[model samples]
Target: MSTIERKTVVLTGASGGIGMATAKALTERGFEVIAVVRDPSRVRDVGAVFQADLANLADVVRVGRELAEKVPRIDVLINNAGLHAFSQRTTVDGLPVMVAVNHVAPFLLTHALLPKLRASRGRIVHVASDAHRRVTTLSLPDDLVRTAQFSARESSFLYAQSKLLGVLFTKALARRLNGTGVVANSCCPGLNVTGLGRESRTFAALAKVLAAVGAFSPASGARIVVRLAADPESGSTSGTHFSRDGSVKVDTTLVANVALQEQLWAETARLPAVSSLGDFR
Candidate 1:
């Protein structure tokens, strides 16, 4: 089968695991892979790499402007950078670390790149997770940002909620990009033993056990994202969620209420991190 030529893809979280695997896979397949990462020294052999810490909103803006100036167009944007913090932490902008890293940073980056993406008729792939289903409620209280108390269990729940917000953000962005050539979709990569949890020793051991038991490898986990970015058929699919196998998947509660999604979008927009982006359509 013939493949697309000169395709450009910007992927966050490329320092390791699924992100690193995806960067290699895409580059080997003839796509120009731009690896967005925080530590440049850790990345090796990626086609092109940029360093930016997504936890900082100012860095997000600076990186966005720098990327826009450097790249003429972006054929695909993969919002794969994420954090699974086991404690409460805040960014320089004062937003929760999980929320900032997982959602707001990608939101700002994608918004800043929209014009370039539209010019290339690009696709957006958000590496969300089925863990979103674990979030008991979508409402984030005003004090949620202020409270610093957190346990590992509570942090897991918050991380899941951040992923849920990613799903909603994808939906809202798709609607906003309607009539443009850009398409947006989110997906769950299934359980993967990709060393994504190296931050905690317990998680690292669990990741190893999961790998032994047949949880997908990082390469397998990245397949859906690669497919969404490079497969011609995916050009027509937008505003939907998918599983690792590329099948449509949705949380029933999330799909049932467009109003909730919109409200979430508005609320997220009001977040200081996102609001500071300055008129992102």
Candidate 2:
């Protein structure tokens, strides 16, 4: 039997929970791991660690450039960084915090690294969630970037909308990269007990309680992500959304809108920082 050589993977959101666990799991399998995090001090071990706050487009550009300069090729790129805000917030770029962090940043980073990924015939894994089913609409109003007063219900709804965008983006990206020897797919990690809910004490408590009952461990939740990144079976699968167990999952109706996906791709490309990167597709 021939032993397959492990490949290099670039993973974001590595300072905590699912991302942290996934980093360790990939390392254990002998893959070269380039873990990206907001806080460099928080990462304990990895092949390499890069720091950048995903909410900032400039920071995303900086991190992308830095990675491009240092790493010659990337076999896999995992877009795992995310934020669940209980209230509305805006970034320095004036975009809604959750949308910027969960979608735009990942979009920019992935596009910026596409050349290297293409060179290696890499795969891109986007971590999505079932919560996206709750998003009934996809609207990017003129003032959508502004932070507005939000009820608890509205906050969750908006968060789901962001995840839905992720699913749509993954599909669109896969199509754009077709026949390039690169594949992109999205997956839901399920309800894992992660610090993602750190903003709410109640949520944190509930996560801890559920984790105690074996609802899901960060390690277990990270399996699909690791599998997609390393498993040979997934090499040819692109534009599909998957569940925790590696089964196919359909995106919500709102997310399945191809027109909306193209609109988002064009609008995202219009962003000053994103535009500066030149033609990514």
**Global lDDT for candidate 2?**
0.86
The whole-model lDDT of each prediction reads: 0.83, 0.86
Q: lDDT by residue for model 1 over 1-281, one digit each (tens)?
A: 24545888999998888898889899888888888899999898777788899999889888888888898778999999988888888788888888888888888898778888999889999999888877666655452265476888687788888888888889888988888988999998877777556767899999888778877788899998889888889998889889888787545686446787787767767776667768653
Each model's TM-score?
Answer: 0.92, 0.93
Candidate topping TM-score = 2
Error of 2 at 235 (Å): 0.3
Off by over 4 Å in 1: 1-4, 140-146, 209-215
- Output the number of the lDDT-best candidate: 2
Clashing pairs in 2: none
